[model samples]
Target: MADRGAGTMSLPDDWPDHANAILALNRMGSFDWDLDAGLMVMDAQAHAIFDILPEEYDDRPETLAVRVPPNEARRLDATVSQALKDGSENYGAYFRIRRRDGTQQWTHTQGYIRRDETGRPRRIIGVVRDATQELADIATRRERLEQDTALREQTNVVQLTTAALAHARTVQDVIDVLKDTHGLTHLGATSLVMGLVEAGRVRLIAEGPAGSFVAGTDVTGIDEPYPMNEVVRTLSPRFIESPEEFAAGYPILWPHITDLRITSAAYLPLIVQARPIGAMGLLYNDRRGFTAEERNILVALGSSIAQSLQRAMFYEQEKDIAQGLQQAMLPRTIPSVRGADVAVRYRAAAIGGSQGRDIGGDWYDLIPLPGGRVGAVIGDVQGHDTHAAAVMGQLRIVLRAYAAEGHTPATVMARASVFLHELDTDRFATCLYAEADLATGVVQVVRAGHIDPLLRHADRSCRRIPVPGGLPLGLSAEFGSLEYPVSTVELDPGHTLLLCTDGLVEMPGSDLDDGMRTLTALIASGPEDVRRLADMLIDLAEERGGDDDVALLLLHRRGLDAPVGGGRLQQHVAPGDPEALHEARHMVRAAVHTWGARDRADEIELIADELITNALMHTEGAAIVTLRALAGGRRLRVEVEDSSSALPRRREAGESGVSGRGLLLVDLLTDDWGVEARGGGKCVWCEFDVPESDRRRPNRRR
Candidate 1:
């Protein structure tokens, strides 16, 4: 090549063959711009690269400019101007050109700037190469990389969420963990909502952001047009990418969406083990589409969420069962009698400040015993789960059985300890038992590794009874029946007796002693209303939120009235002896005459004879008779305590033999007569309504 004209290259005629052969190898050719001549020339290959005929050979700048897209032409012009100004030897740019055939091609065009001695441009020369294939290849690779990256990210999210969901025991627990770093962060979920199919409706039990249909709101049937209900019915996933779509898809929910500011939302059925349990939902603040991968991830999580929701429901139902079983094992009501008022409170254990799930094994009982005596017991088994509650239930039945057998408090606990130990439950229980005699104002306590009793006297002074306690039942016991030491304390008139499980007093950062002191002080200055006092004590104990279940028994000794020379006497009679009946009658008559109630002596004697006779007949051991003048001698009570566990019940004597009518006769003779259980025995007792009273007499102990 040589310059035959001003600043232009001239090629030999043979150069065409070599240039065309090289251009064929690389889809490239050469072009020249002769600025001084104001002419442009293209090689044969350049003409073919532009997809033009040979007649297009007289190349002016406009000739190539016509093929360049406007945007590419401007960009090329800028690059050329910069190159010329910078006086660069060569510079290259890539741009798109539309061929004469109306097809676009990407060309990599590089040009050289030739300057004269005065640094002025003479001619421009450049090479044009087709780059369309290269550009398409790069784009293909980029798209493939993006897909792989998306797949990896989704896999990571699924792995992390599955691990987290494994530890979630409840639906709420699962929901709470999803917002942690790796979870909802990738989900882009502004709100997480859970819907359960309850009673033929989709109910939102829990939600996030506290919006988008209130928590616990119900979505009705498929005809309702709620996305949640639709998902539940169809067992499929719903995607509303825009508010308009949502409005169209769920016309009934359009206003709700607007009110909730839900730009986009999704509803997916919560299917567990291939069964549709409910629907789960998510809400977003921006209108967005769920990626195929993202929607798949949510669908996978659907199973886990459904399982967790079912688990939470099962947990609650089990808690109900445990609590119901625990309560059913205890007394439903206690006696309301002349000398005492009783009340009880029982609460299961709490977990994380929520009251349910873990049922504490605690129990309380107020049993009516022989001789107008009432027996009270409170106990607790270790732990706060179903097993503990079951053991607590069994142990409660054992305690009641023992207490009803006419055993003393110590005797009952001893027998209970042996029973639990021999049963091999591998558990332990702390128990307190007390029998209070209303007539004498005496309370006998038996403790087995239990909290001490709180006694608040008439002066409002409170003290914990110092009873020696034995080991907790079900651990190693003494060779025989495990007997705890009996401690006696007089609960006089106007005194309050408090017995409770450890949960009442024990709290975090506080031990049994600290809790006892706090409880004692709280009850000491509290009101005398048995119900009120029970509530106050529990409220105070629950103030710090204990971890254990609590059972509290409260009894206030009724204030005694002034006795008007009425007598109080108890006689012990021998077993298998008819003389026991005679002795009982004599004692009743003597008390009736002494109390100026001789007008009722015959009735009193008759009732006393029946009670003692029943007791003696029903027992092989001795019978103890107690006669008391109550309500200012307007009420006479004759109680017979026997050493037999057999409780005498009134039945149809049926004209067979004599003596089946003993309780019947007493029931008719006395205002009231009922049987009370005692240690190893039971008592058949009767009360007589005294006909007369003198109100002006001095007050005395009956």
Candidate 2:
């Protein structure tokens, strides 16, 4: 190089090496200060450090002080004075200096103070290295670790909140679980409030700390704009870091902000499936700047929170309507038959694609036929919609009417099939009708294209019974005349018969034959009690991949091995035959006195008379009465059967004529009187249990 600058030490001929060395390391610049003159001489490197040119450099202490900020200048003076006072040979300090490029640079200088023979400082020489890049790299690494830790903490908070939300049942449950979750505070949330959008209004779901919110407060209208509305409208998170910003964006919430002493806050919008369901708000006592990563985490948490809240609200609303419809249409208790143990189960699916909570149109009915026989029927409409459910209810009424008209199983099935075909419904239904003669151990089955009934033999072997029948109800009209043929099977005591809809044996992505085999195995290896068996089947129907509703009916025949009780009495009285009343009276007297229930003899006799009389006069078929003794002769029960499904109401006693008081008489003369739906009709039955004192009397007629 030509003339390597004046007032500098002479370097080797290869000046490029020296320049490369300075460039590789931090640029080291030198300065000299004269103790007597109070001035400095800066090198070109030092001038570059100050973002200055050689022409702009000045050798004056005041000039250097002007470049150094007040704080750093004071630091410089203190360091140099202490070094001189302590008689130290060296002084060093790190400070910031203002540059001509409008940037501040971190600089560190170390100097040696030389003294003369009089013990006074003569001159000072120092070097300054710009540590800006190195220091910035160190700071960046530290901040990254902190951010990593915070992100982990935020992820943990989300996991904890998600676990708590699973068991939440309502919007309030969402708030309660969140309040109990302490991870939010760890994520810098001093306080939190959850709000839900409902009916065009913002309803406060819950707030932490006992008295944070008023009960049932709807923040619907406000005099000034609020940041919460901005979040909901934009579906974006907002971070307000100061009181002025909070007041400016949420003027309506200023009072609450003042009460909370809030200096900063965050509003994260809860969006689910691109729909804004609500928002979560976090409050802080100090202004905090949110990093991009932190805001991103909060946005994800908002989505999760919104998903859980929406799921809960939908479940609650759907269940209410389903339960109401089920209660109104279904029979409460299974009728007590004389020779068969009967059980029924119904399962409604809560989730079906597009069809939320509408229960499928699957129903089973028990009808008490003439001659001590029971008529059982189970049917299912083709679809699982509200329209299908309504159609099912109407079809139940028609089936009951036709069966009670003294028709055979085939006739009843044919009429019901024709009725549905003539109706205005767009769906079809499948049905299986069976007349079970408990007295004769004989069952007659008429199928209308429904699933075949399962017959489990007393020897523990199971098989499906085939029935030659016509098309499913509505389809019979479309295809041809109802060609239903009755099939008969005798239950040799200890045998079980099962009837169900297709839902019980259908699984996603599985063959129907496979489900049938599985069900057969379940039935053969299961318990004998009808109720327990029904429970197991219901569990199977609700397992994963089972998306349809199920309706099941089980009828079992008691073998002679069944434990013997006191004697039983049963009779059949043909309709419009007055002479059958005398026979019924004789049967009741023998049943009551045989069981030693003489005290309620007159009361039970009158109760049976009214029930049979009403049935014979209004109903088309016979009125049969049965008396059975239960609990070792301590309780006497009477059942008067009719071929009418219409239940008689307890009305005011007739003023003049001897009519309309049948139900009232039964109600007043018996311990219990109610109409049970069975055998395509109703059973008006009464039970007279002996009092504690009377149960011990030995054959007394008191």
Candidate 3:
């Protein structure tokens, strides 16, 4: 054992035991320093810390300091000095030292300083231990903290993006959100390209970043289809990781895509009802790879977008078909009455907005009566869409039949009301039926829960015709009691009768009185003809209350002598028995020759004979035929009237039906042939092309 300074206590001979015990228990070593003698002492465990033998120590503090690494020596000296200067009893610091074997070790040194009575440092004693494990542990904790922070930030971004996508209203909106977010993070552009399958075309409805691809360039002529086309065709999704692969697989899009600098893309099919309507292509500007989570999010968003687009398309198609069917159900042309000029006008709703299928229960008709009288009707069913149109058609036919059978306006409406109530057609309807006797200028009207018709006399004053009775048709068993009163008014020359549907009176932002006022003002404007009046009334309604579908019919009674036979007639012919055909041919030839139509007499005679004879044989009744030469050289019309009211249906040639062959013949021979209803019967009519040369001939009455 070495002798130490006065303040240092000499270690016992058994010090090794304590030293060894400390080393085994805590992997630590012990050391001491003598300030006065400048001597240092270390246990065998301390020697082991530096990989040096305990016998190598010279028992001198200066010698030990010389053995310490230069950097560690300075650090230890500074700590010891600080403790002594502060007159502290203990001090500690961590330092790095090199072992004899040239390995570095981190260590902590703690010391106790002995002070004189005045609290000045005299000597110092301490122990040093290896701390490499603690340092390593701290480093690991710092790395873990950094990793966790990054993961949390990514999760927050994903959650925000998902919420944004979920709330998007349209596919375009969803694509926009995705494109914007993706561009913010990835510094790339995005685009949504759609392929319309039915049209065999592609369109880009929404494009992000550049937004220049929104109109879509045609890639249909490409040799191979794009992945989006395949996805739609196969009902699957595809991801293209490389531009080269895309160009190889879809050569047509290669030129366009190469210019776009799209390095990565995804193609998703937009499917509805198990059928593909189109494909959505998501393009990225740089080569990119999607993780499983990101791909899942995109797929879900694609499906949602597809469903929304499909819903919008279905709504549009349904509206279009309904509107088309409704228009087809309406009468194409008003029947020309001998003693009255008639006109009608119908307008459809604008496209794409919520005003779907402008078809409603509104309807109108003009029926020619005995003694140059004309019957005009305007009515509304209780609903809209196809059901209403069907109901209106039924009412129209029934009322026309009743009027042609000579029923008075009141009696006609009474019977119609009862028929409607008892009829199995599960619909309720309203109507205003009126009959104008042109010879006496007496107008008779009946209203069945319908708006009263307006009358504008030659004095330019307007009034609602008084027909105050009846409930809407199909409402009750006692509908006959609700029969409208027959109101009669003597017509003055040049007076006009205007019949309209509720769509006219029930315009938006206006009450019944306001509508009446508007309509009366319109009538006072004094249009030139019934056609002009009908058009103006509908226009006025639209200006005031365009929320509904409008239907109007106007009638102006003309003097009995006003150009009675001014319009021309057209004739169509079919195959029939030779004898009847020949007799009809002779009549046609004689009529045409009498009218000095020598140039077309032969063609007209042949066409008329075939048409009349075919009507007589196949129409199942006595056929009444009439011929008229049209004005303005427009057409020559021939009408063969039959008692049978069953409409002539067109059929294929060689069919079992007896009428099939005749229609084929007519179609081959005539420019056009149509069947219309006459009073209590049907008329199969045809038109023939009259040459300009034949029209130039002078009229020579027979």
Candidate 4:
């Protein structure tokens, strides 16, 4: 026995029986462990505590392995080794040991290390006891029952949280889920703080409880004294059971959160695949300490959160990449056109679920062409992915090039279709291209498996222009339907022409025609400003979210600062095509009458017929006839173009000859005539002066 301090009792060195009696009475046993000799000496009472007889006892600790399970022995050895290496004065642990009857019993052990003068551990004095009865007592059973109930509640909360997190597709969405009123609060947390590990630093992504966030903590080092950092570093959970423990363990983080009145917290390492990706802290104000079961429950919850957060992060990254690619594929900016208010817009799709990316092939462009013409294009590729966007980019470039090459509307569309088919991609696109001559208010529109363009009248009423179309780009060329019909429409001053992908007019569960009619009504009631009208349509599409993208173009013809009533009309006349020549005559008559020159409609139609007839008879190609009301409706000019460089000369015609009489009639009409050399062709133009009374007449039809 060692000497005792004042007022304390001491036993003589020879009082072994007294110490044995005290240990036996308490159902505890004492042992002496020699570190240098690797041996242990246990008394009869200690053998009894281990449920072993005197004959079964061993002087060496290795011999005790027969009584202690291998797992229990290893755990005990490790605990002892850690305590000794850390210079711990004492250590205690609980383990399970199999008894002689093949039954498991809970056992506890405590050891006090004895160090020599040189500070090296020499021996250990310890006590072993059976803790089964202590653990099975009435109070402990009741406490464990409460802990079990709390575990069930916590598990339920975790399930609810996981369900909520399933819908989170972005990092911000994850934060919103965590900060939702009905969220994480069910986990018995008064406040929550979460951080993601980024580039060896923990970024504070979420902090709640309204103003509890400390400034300058948005990012922190992993080696900081904060409990979150501690768990992340160790890949283990930390239970701060009291404010005192929290303050002592995290001196730097305590002062900032003292005002929160937090009494306890649980910090968990958000680990996946045995590596920590981030960390989370659940703070408590009403609770004082956490039971072992509660700590385990929180750790499980943290694992679920880690998986969801990783998924959300990956989704956001993919979305960003998809959007960036789509934006790069689309036109960077629209070119301004003279004599028109042009507005263009594009919106990407809002796709959901594990698809992870939201992008599509919708695109719009404004291409300036030769001869005072501008091409407005709106198209959508067949899919919603990076591949579709790539195809769209190639198709848009080719379409622009064809339009800029002075091709007619139909030729441009056919060439684009051929280009797309030759690209060898298994994709197709619906497209509409409108070539408008702002000077003449004439729009030649060509459609390729796309919806009709909308024409808003000067009165703000809108209607669909039913343009005949061929198959979509790739399919048309594949099926040999390369001829796209062009429809001509007059875009009067103050009227607008609208072209958009079907995404703008499609409504789920509704017929496409019905959707178009609805769109027409919407446009009719929308504001008159082109830019504002474009915004309104796009905003509506955004509000009615769908799994498709949208592209739109609006071209509003500005009222010219010159004349108000005069107009121009053009028609292409092919050789030996009576219908085209007849259309050319009708166009001349209509333009003359619409310009209030009905009295001269007969003369104008006759002269236009003779010119078209001569061009068709003498040329190997088609004739283009153009009629214009000039000088504010006081004069009308007719021009006929042919792919021939030869100039026409007056010839004497006998009474019965019809071939040489065509140019003679033009000389007989009251008009000035001339010829101009065009590229590989010639244009013969004539002008007619109208009477003032007829010019001042109201617009009328014959």
Candidate 5:
């Protein structure tokens, strides 16, 4: 072989016979391009295929730009460069080239790379051929099949959009689904614009892909020239295929969005039941037109969106009403109780769960009772509807009345049960009532088929107090078992009592005891402030997302000037009951010693016994004796209340007698003494000052 000319190479001696004839017969021409020399050698047939004469084309590859369009040449260069960089041996591509008459025709090319020993491409040998007729023939054969495939794909997009819209419960939810990346964005829309028809105006509710909003298009009149407005007013879709048409039709909007380079857009009216509710627009920057299939898909999706929006509107409207009713039924403000910190919270259940009621029967109330007592109530009606809420309101009112009327905890619960049973509806309710005397640190709890309450000690340790219970409010009266047992919990200063409906103590598939243990642990680790602890618990319930509503009440006894390590014990002493008197004496002695008053135990016990004896002797009824440790265990107080209103007076005792020496002994051995009118009776109380060092005594005494 020899180099015959600058752009030619002579055939080799070992070349196969008729090789040139074979290539010519197939209308293929060959060329060789040198990477280092920047030269391309083409045969006569190759020159003809490129619509250039042998003399017109120089050996430089750039000369081919006369026949190849700039876009096509760049595309080809990219294909070849990628193949060379990726270590590919060959590359092929179809591109359009301008013919001699300035008409473009499809051309196909195949090239093989020749690399040096180091894998650096040095040359490329390829063949080019005319592919215009071949492509035209294939397009004719597959046109119908392609159309059907496109239609199916468009229809599938509609189905997917509708399925996603099915879960939209609110207007914002529908907007989210539409704007999601895997949603309508998958259809290659560069921007989405949506508007609702409100009061004869098109209100733009959503428009995105950041910075796509036009300033004055937020709210447009129905007669405005905006595309969305046009579609909504006409109840028909408007497809803008070109920027010129858009600018001509919407001159006001086009000037504002000129920088977006939008080439086409489809604005569809949101129609349901033959009425237009809104409009949506899908804007595209890369395409110039929409096919019939695409138009149909967008219209169908618009219909689905319209229905979803209507449903969401109705849902929100109903929810507002239900929430208003529930709020009206619940207590507007919790009455402040002295000597205690109180917090109450209510959380509605998650919608679309087991019972998708946005308004529930859960409720909480705080009632200020007489004599420095506060009543805390938590209850839940059987159902999760307005009926349940109505019943709960009535029950709450009656329960508050009973508690404020000085009824005992058990009686309050029993009366509430009877009231519920007498209601016209057949609903049952679980209730827990606690009457707490903050001054005395005693809480009387009554439970009727309700979860046990939690007690948080001053040390932050928490435990469940299992108060005995009767049936639910309505069921108890029906079954003739209205006895709600009273459980007394002695709360020290800084101690808190937690009352809540079972929703806070019941998880799916878990035992009630297990849930209680979890709640106890949570409370133990919670903040000491009652308000913060209540917020934390309610937040937990919100995160758990259960089907039942929750009602919580937290009452923390304030530590204002309260003695530390104080305790109270009460016992009844009957006039003629020897056993009652013995029990009262034993209780007084034990409490006095245990309260770090061991040095004065004898005097305190003697004072308490003499007071009890005087009350029994002077009064016609039993006496109530109460022993309390006060002043941070620095003092012990003894109280004996009798049915008679006679106040005890200091009297002298006979030298050898015991009958008149009770008050005299109480006066001599006590640091202070007083008598107060208690209802129809009088209470004689005495205090004994004990040294703080006595608290360090051994656990047992001789």
Candidate 6:
């Protein structure tokens, strides 16, 4: 190379014709600068770089330096100084320079600096190339590099965030992952918008940054619309590069956003299953614009988040339906039993999850037994889910079956336990079985690893029955072999028995004894009825030990000699012929027998026939018959009823009518007789007293 280190002389020094002929070049430029003097010199081609005439730079470098753009002058000086300090023989920098016509063009100057022997810089010489084409080429390369870098960064962020969003089940879970993974704080200021097309509304389901925004506040009614509205309506992604842009579009959110210092934002429409349900917006505090790549990544995350929300809502609805169905299958109210008052209460769990709606294993039953007896049972299986509830239902049916077979309390429990053990079940259960016979005023109890029942006596005192306890059912192979002895107590009149599950007494900070004391206090207060008392007791337990499910059954014994009576019967019949009279007599006899007047059955039958025969022969069309049975000191009074609209005409004993003989027979047989009109019907009565000997006979049919 000829003089490769030449300062501003890298091109041939020949005439313009020679340089043009060598390379068929159309244009060229060269220049020199005097740094200390702040002067510059240029050739004809160099002057053309600034679009200036060649005479403009003759004998003066100041003209060219002065022609340089003011804003780029400092940059040009710095480049010149840097090149001289590095002692580079050749160097180039691209900058903007002003032309004499007040227009601008890009230039690339390449040159070197001349120095004295002491290494001090003297003058700067450079070749000024009109590099508008070169500048365009470099800018194209830079643009490509920037685009690639931005795309790479977006791909990385989307891949990482998508993985996190994939695992988010709840709205809170999404917020947590975003905060932790994306270095985001102030989560509460953020809102998740979900579209509700059916309601023609958009809902804010979840918000983060705990104290900033209320969890359930609805922004639907805000005065000015949100940019997210566009996202949803258009089903596209949108972004606000600055707070000014957002405020200009949404004036109402401006104040709220300014107070939060939100400067930039991205609104992404959430589309799932090829449908757009809503949009999500990410707000930032600085005016940071999201790249196209970033917007696309956010869209992917929004889609996944939308799908998760849909699934969660579906799960919640399913849980509610299952819970309702389960409760409907349970008893609404306990059955009524004579000689005893009964009550029951049931409760389910309050947890949320897959097993949330499955019933627990706690259960209670009050079955009426023969001879005015009531069978009571309270049991709990070994789990808190649907399987346990199924086992409990099976045990209940089996217990009732055994009781119906007339097994003793201990026998019923023994057989039930054995059946449960033999069943192909993986869970065990505890139970307490008891029977109360109101006639005998006795209670028989059997316990199998269950909580003991509490008895509140008529005296306002309490006692807990201690029966022989056995292992929980289903745990032993020889379940019935373990004889659980029967325990009995005299259930006196006005006394109450309470059977309950462990959930009643097993409170969080208190034990079984404390629960028993609380229950005892409740029962001792003497509630009016068994049902009322049962409710009070359950409420008390819930106040103290509501962590678990509760089940309780209460029974109150009535006095053995309590008086019982029958209601009136108003009957309408056609005027009786002989057949009608016989039917009326049969009805009176059956009524007296059902009212426990069996000893007077024959006498009442004959008296009713004579009275009814007289009424049928006297009245026309339909006749009403009435029967009344009054218990009077070992005797029953019988009444024959009919509607005559007129009183019967009685005759003296000497009167010789064909029906006159009927009254004489009634007077001879019965101790008393009378006639009275009851409403629209008249009652003719006769009484028969039981003999002293007959009264002592046992009433075997109860």
State every prediction's TM-score relative to the real structure: 0.64, 0.54, 0.51, 0.65, 0.67, 0.46
Instruction: Give all candidates' CA lDDT scores.
Output: 0.74, 0.75, 0.66, 0.83, 0.84, 0.66
lDDT of 3 by residue, 1-702 (tens): 245422234433534655557654787776767676667677666667656665666666556653478878888889888878876788999888777667778888787777778786666666777887887788788777865664455455555656665555444545565566542243232665665565555444544346344224544422236676678667888877788877887786577556677888878787777877767777787657665655665566566666667655665576677777666767767788755677887665432234345567677788876434578887777666777777777777888888886566876777777777777677777788878755446678778788888888777788877667578777733533654677887665677788887677765567987877777776878576777777777776656546467778887766544323333233333345455455556667766765556766655666666667656766655565666654334355677777667877666755456545666666776766777655467777776666777667776654
Stretches of model 2 off by over 4 angstroms after superposition? 1-7, 10-280, 283-319, 352-355, 560-702
Q: Which stretches of model 3 miss by more than 4 angstroms?
A: 1-191, 199-224, 241-245, 257-264, 283-294, 338-341, 348-358, 457-463, 476-482, 490-494, 522-547, 557-702
Task: Name the lDDT of candidate 2.
Answer: 0.75
Write one digit per residue (lDDT tens) for candidate 6, span 496-573.
888888887776677788977876776778576777777776777655534467788888776554212242333455
Task: Compute the lDDT of residue 587 as modeled in candidate 6.
Answer: 67
- Report the candidate with higher lDDT, 3 versus 5: 5
Task: List the candidates ranked by lDDT, beginning with the highest.
Answer: 5, 4, 2, 1, 3, 6
Tens digits of per-residue lDDT, candidate 1, 240-356, equal: 888778878777657655766778887888887777778877888865777777778778777666776677667767777877877676676666755677888987666763435
Alpha carbon deviation, residue 640, candidate 5 (Å)? 14
Worst 10-residue lDDT window for candidate 5 reads: 1-10
Native RMSD of candidate 6 (Å): 16.6
lDDT of 6 at 410: 71
> What TM-score number comes out for model 5?
0.67
Worst 10 residues of 4 by lDDT: 1-10
lDDT of candidate 3?
A: 0.66
Query: Model 5: C-alpha RMSD to truth?
Result: 10.8
Give the 10-residue window scoring lowest on summed lDDT in candidate 2: 1-10
TM-score of 4: 0.65
